[model samples]
Target chain A: MSVLEVNHVSKSFGSNTILQDINLAFEENKIYGLLGRNGAGKSTLLNIMTNRIFPDAGDVKLDSENINDNDTKLGLMYLMSEVNLYSNGTTLKQIISDTELMYGDFDHSFAARLIDEFGIDINQKFGKLSTGYNSIFKLILALCVPVKFVLLDEPVLGLDANHRELFYSELIQSYSDNPRTFIISTHLIEEVANIISDVIVLDQGRIMLDQPVEDVLAKTHSVVGPAKDVERYTKGLNVIGHDTMGTIKANYVYGDLDDRPLPDTVQLSNFDLQKLFIFLTNKYEGSMHSEN
Target chain B: MKTNQVTKYLFKKQIVLLGELYLFAFAIIFLLPLLLSVISGTLSDYSFVGLLKGAHIAALFGIFMIAISTLSYENFKFLIQNGISRKTFFEAQLTVYGILILIGNTINLFYDYLIVVPLTHASTFNTFMSLYADFFDNPFVSVTFNFIFSALLLVFGALAGMTVGSFMTLFSKLTQRIILIATPVVGVVTMAYVANATNNAHYQMSWVVNFAKFIIGENGNDVLNPFPMMGFLLVLSAIMIVIIRYLFAKKQLKKA
Candidate 1:
């Protein structure tokens, strides 16, 4: 059993704190969704975890060994970010082969199958790849490398609907086949909500929520009815955020609902991961703004 | 072993690059000119090729190192992407460059002594002999001294390339432009001031001359005494290696 831990990590750029006291443990053989809005420090956290960037006041460790510039420890993890790090003249085949050399193991047949399935010409130079294809290639690297942990930052950037669907299915299949830990950071909450086993919501340089998705969804509810009735029904519950449309309203709650007689126009339904995420991040931002 | 693999790959590329460079250079300087002279029935005539044959092998290797080490940005990006520790890649690259420099200068030594001087009939092409033969009669002692001097220069060239590459990639465009413009202006102004002060005797300039001469020996003897120069170069190289290692410790991913 392998575990990657980010222990009390804090990073700041100039006066702006990117990540503040982030402490999380990722056990192997699970999928975690790292959800955040723009500039919520998702990328910064991922960079720090992968040793691509330094943390100001903490360390990331794999199996109890610090991974900062430790080749043996780092070799067990790979981070696929939205950066073109390969040489312009290198072909995709060559890059993949070189990656295999570095990590000592890569699923060549699976990679070959993926290239064919993705309609990618591996002979083409990496620089000439389209934005969508570039994302696809990086996703392939993330999938094929036989590492214990893989962190993907915006894995589906520039990917079209079909490609994103294909990628998600392949990701699920690969996870099932190998059972490595994957922590994905992306804005596409709805698309990855079902596949992700755990959800980590980041907001305002802090972790707003970190829980199993099923556990989170079990307590989350969308109370929809007349605005006054919905408010009355959820008066004591933890209301994260809500939406109002004229006389009607839907208050999103993060905790259990009270056992009260339902109002005539009131209705209760389980909210989705996206809705939960939206309300959670929105509420956190609101609190941050009020504090400032 | 992984470092060895990395060194192998990098050295392979450098070998290919050096081969191509030598092929092109030798063709222009030796082959083409020799052919032209032969065609014109002037095979024995003195020419530019003979003059250029005097270029030191170590210096040329240093030039080659600068070129490849400057392009090391490409390798850095690739290596860092693959999760190679900075220490691993740095050690691998420096080891490769060191070995290549050693082999390159050794080949130069052999080729000049055996082929160039014998064929061109020009002893001036023998750079090591000209530099050290006056002070040291023993070839072994002289060559050892020459090797240290050449190694220092190549290491400096390699370190300079790494610095330039890092500077180009790490800083913002505005900062780079400002530094680029400011550096030469400052250097020129300082040089003019130094020249003026030295000519007018306004500043004690003997320390300046003495400082330059300090590299020669303890007594500032410039006549074939390479012991002080060797000691100075070794210490300078040691300092540079330490500085370079420190700078390379914690580099994050910059924009490609």
Candidate 2:
């Protein structure tokens, strides 16, 4: 069943429209990746879904009820990059106390354990923590909280490589243990490619792609062959992106890869999420520029 | 569960704010007086009794400051974004502030009796009784005049703070900018008004002037009339608070 449903939602700031007639549904017990470029309205859509911000038109429902009627649906943890916990005088212990107070099922023990694992000083004030540690601390809290849904916006934005790997491992482990809905929104698409069960690509506030991760990967393939042969073979297919090198060519093609056979000389590779995102956004940009 | 959640959140917030208030009160009551006593020694002849009275007045002013400062844009934003309703939040703040003011007043009264009276070799009980008499004299008159005037000042200060805080919320992107620009302008305008009013006798006694006098304790006509001015300020404050709560209830948090 869909745990979250956003229907025909539109949002505008003055004359600049942010989200336009967007619709999406989130299923329970799945890890979904929400990917987009900067200023693509991904965060705005998340805010509307979480009831942090109201939409100009349309409604978001959680568990079949309007979110505004019961904003406790916001009790569903939303760890946005911008919506920081207190800084200056606030400590991790105080934050835990606050979280336990505000949320019914906050796992204090789990949070403590995660804090220990992340090497966060419980006594240190939030403002004193390094940027990477700040992100780690927030991620730990989001993972430990026993809410029905958890939305992590750019959770690993400041993490080093090691911490990023550790974050993904902990996130996966937590999901496996609790089996709740998790929506991870980030520009770092490839980092979460393995963990996300579903992928939703947003562009200009519209959902460009929403499908199972496996299906999305299977539908797109990269072809490397002679430039003329690649162009001829890629004709009538949706070529997301292409590059040429000394009479040889590489093209990112989107379609049912399993349904067609390529020439023996052509090298085929599975499309990575990062490459897919870059291709899609670049394609949109190219089209817009051409139109202009 | 809802009550527990709100209480916990509000309690945490209040604890932090109270710490700041204590520091502020300590500075104003203990430190400032000590500095003044050292600077001129003008208060040296007054004895501790006068010092206690001064402290009592300072404490009352501190309570007013605390009440006003508690209403902020951050608090409003939290109320709107979190599941906590604006009505509930405002009621909680009012309840907390009222309790705090009562406690502060009690402590001040105790200090007046315990420390001031003995030091001055004065009858503290007699002073208390006289003050009470002063408060209730001509039941209708004193109630209308002094008591109501002071109450209105407190309410007006709080309403002013909340209204300004609400306006600050609208300039969310450039809150610091707005504050930086508006603070000096407000300060200058207020000073200019004060200077102008002190020089103009007719302007001072106008109905507007009388109302301002009633607020600031400058009205010389002390025929102990139940200060309807206090009721006026209270009702005005109540209206502003209601409007503030309504606007806050409808507000939404900005997106990530």
Candidate 3:
């Protein structure tokens, strides 16, 4: 029954506004994908939510209480980001112990299993961990801690294909067992496309899209046909972006499609999340120029 | 529950980890006399017990410096990330440092006074046991004053450590460098001022000595009352704890 709410939150670094009046609520027992390009303020927003950094204005609350300095509420949430906040000399085992001591409960057996599966040495010093293993180590903590909300910022930063695959499967299994909320912020959209239930797209310090995956995909589609026929068929539709290949063209359009008869050469396909995200982010500032 | 966990966390980090290094240093310092004796084929009359006592006192300052230098904002960030509030962090520090002071004083008393002084039969070492014997004729009062003085030294070292830690956490690298360069100059100037003030009869009272005497329950009139000194230390410690909390709470994660 817990709900994490960010109300009227805004932050600015000198003249550059990072987050502008961001107001969002996360319900319980759901997976939310936080999608944003570089410098889109994804990490900043996550940092603020976890109390790693204070926002310039407004507050983040858990249920009805302010989360800042509230141990009871903060204990219910965790954030795994790129920052190496762990001390230099601490070992992975010590890290787990410290985390368990702080959060009051941790899945030791599960963490051990994941450590073995990933071939991560629990005795190794945290500072000596490689980039990929560091991510894996943090990912393990994110999964094992018995918290209500886990915000993962770039969870698979240096993970390879095999590790990423293993992580996703383990994540799904963990989610199935615990059914807590997870907000994964990553650039690898295609990999997490099917796993995430909700998609929150941020662009230029603003939330461009916040909807269910199905709803977002339903409203966006690609029309593929000869250049002349494709342009003629979708002239009045909302064309966010498009791709061109000599005579053939596919216009990535958003919004409802008209119930008109289609040409034989025309092909209609559902929009992929990555493509939709690209178009949505690029639609503004006239940067969605068709690739020749 | 949260406070206990944080206390345990800090104890493991600060005491257990750093205690090993400190004990190693103490062992080396304590064994210096034996090593010197072995090299010379005969021990000199210089009191080994006195040397050990001196080393223990130096260890107190070392403890404060090491603790403060090692206590960085990284730990603060780590604790907060794990849901430890600033208040809890402050409480944990005070409890840990206070316990450290008590434990340190007990060990000093046990080995330096009980074992070393008796074994060495060093009469000079007995003087510390009756440090203010000339000023206060009562043996009990003198010993109590010595114990309180030792405790105060430990507490003052801890306060300095906290101040240094807060300075390191609050300022940028450039500002820290500037402060580092200026600290010695400031200390020298203050010491010179105190030395110069000692020449004047009207300013004959050394504030440091007076403060120590006041803490040992002896005022200018040689009055014995420990309550005021004890209360002053408690208040001072409380104020330092508040300062530590405020500095940590206002610590910025990243400099812009």
Candidate 4:
């Protein structure tokens, strides 16, 4: 059964509709990648699910129970976003203690290890921390909080390459040790591509694609060869996007590859997640541009 | 039990943060004035002791500001992000209000008993709103009256603080801007009216005068006893809670 269900959720700010008819369900013990471009309503949908902001219509449910103003259901989820809800004078240690108070038990030993690995001073005031350290500290709290579901928006915003690698490994370790659902919204598509099992793509305040990572990749195939031969080979299929380099061409297709033999000049390869995401989003943008 | 745990945690955080603010305000409002008085060697007509007592009132107002500032969106969001719902957060704030009122009035009582009554040599200390000094004729009764009366003052300040904070939180940008510009004008106009009424006996600023008289156990040459002002405060507290809850329910946390 789905642990969390977002049904027909819609939100608007003034004249701008932030989310429109968003329907989603998250199963237990899966890493879900929430992929969307800037201003694509990923954060808005996350905020709505967590009840930080009210939706204009529809509702979010956790375990068949409404999440809004329901302490028991809300207690089952935690959201760590870019906004620093904490005040300037609060120390990291104090924040952790406060989190423990609210959420019952916390993984203190793992948190301490993460803190040491990240070289963060627990006594330092929140406002004194640098930008990268801010994200790191929030990530630590997100990982340690004893909630069944954790939603992280732009979780790795300001991390260096080394820190990002360390975070991913630690996340995997934690998930393996204690299986729980994690919905991470981020722009670094390639980094989380392997880590995430399910992928949900949002564009222009609407869900464009939602499927398993392997399934999405399997459906999207790339045909590369001479420009004319590639076109002939992918004549009737759904061509999402294409790139031309001198005499060679690569056309991305999103449909079942037929059993019919192809020309020798044409080559086919499995679609990478990053390439598939770019082509899918760009295809939607291209349609929008044409419509406008 | 969960609600109690969240309330306890929130109360501790607010108290620590407010304790820092109170210390800072004490330095500026109370200590600075005392230092100036000491350096000048009682140059003013009023006794240095009276000046010090007056500074304590100013410090109380300063604490009220601290309380209002602490009830901000940043703090509210912090509480909610930690899995505390808005309902729980509101309940926690109510607890905070009680805490502030209790601690504030207790400190005021301690000051009146330990410092004002024993150390000061003044024959009479005229408390502006409560006539607390008049109660001094009966030492035991005076302490009791002062505690009750000071609690009322602290309640008023606490209510005002929460109201100001909720007003700032719930209003739109345009409404907030208008309020920011209009508050000083309103204060000045009220002060002018109060000053004018002070001189004319016919004007009868009985709301202030009668309130003070009643708290100090007197009715001021009236045929009938005064209506209980404490009842009004209790009712006001209920109204304030409703208004604050409504405002909080409507408030939206904008991203920063």
User: Candidate 1 residues A1-292, lDDT tens each?
Assistant: 8999999999998899899999999988889999999999999998888888889998999999999878888888888989888878889988888888888889988898899899999999999999999999999998999899989999999999999999999999899888999999998999999999999999878998898999999999888999999999998889888889999999988887668888889998898999888888877778778999
Report the lDDT of model 3 for residue A217. Answer: 89
Residue ranges of candidate 3 with Cα displaced over 4 Å? A225-237, A246-249, A258-267, A285-292, B36-50, B58-62, B111-138, B141-149, B185-232
Residue pairs clashing in model 3 are: none
Task: Show how many residue pairs clash in every candidate, following the order shown.
Answer: 0, 10, 0, 0
All models, DockQ values?
0.58, 0.26, 0.49, 0.55
RMSD of each: 3.3, 5.3, 4.4, 4.7
TM-score of chain B of each: 0.81, 0.59, 0.71, 0.69
Considering the two chains of model 4, state its CAPRI-style docking category. Answer: medium
TM-score of every candidate: 0.90, 0.80, 0.85, 0.84
Tens-digit lDDT track of model 4 for B26-96: 68766777677778886463355664555564356446644664366766777678767777777777777
Q: Mind giving the per-residue lDDT tens digits that candidate 2 earns over B1-256? A: 2545665566567666666776787687677777877788776653444555445553455555545554555554544434444445556665555554445444544564566656665442332233333546465564344333444455566556666655555555577577869899999999898777777776654887677666434445543233354456677888887776766555566433
CAPRI grade of model 1:
medium
lDDT value for model 1: 0.82
| Candidate 2 TM-score to native | 0.80
lDDT of candidate 4 over A1-292, digit per residue (tens): 5479999999898999999999999999999999988999999999999888889999999998988777888888889899888878889898888888888889999999999999999999999999899999999999998888989999988899999999999999999998999999987799999999999999889998889998988998889999999988898998999989999999999889888689988888888888888887888899889999
1 versus 2: better lDDT goes to: 1
lDDT of 2 at A151: 85
Q: Higher lDDT: candidate 1 or 4?
A: 1
Clashing pairs in 1: none
3 versus 4: better lDDT goes to? 3
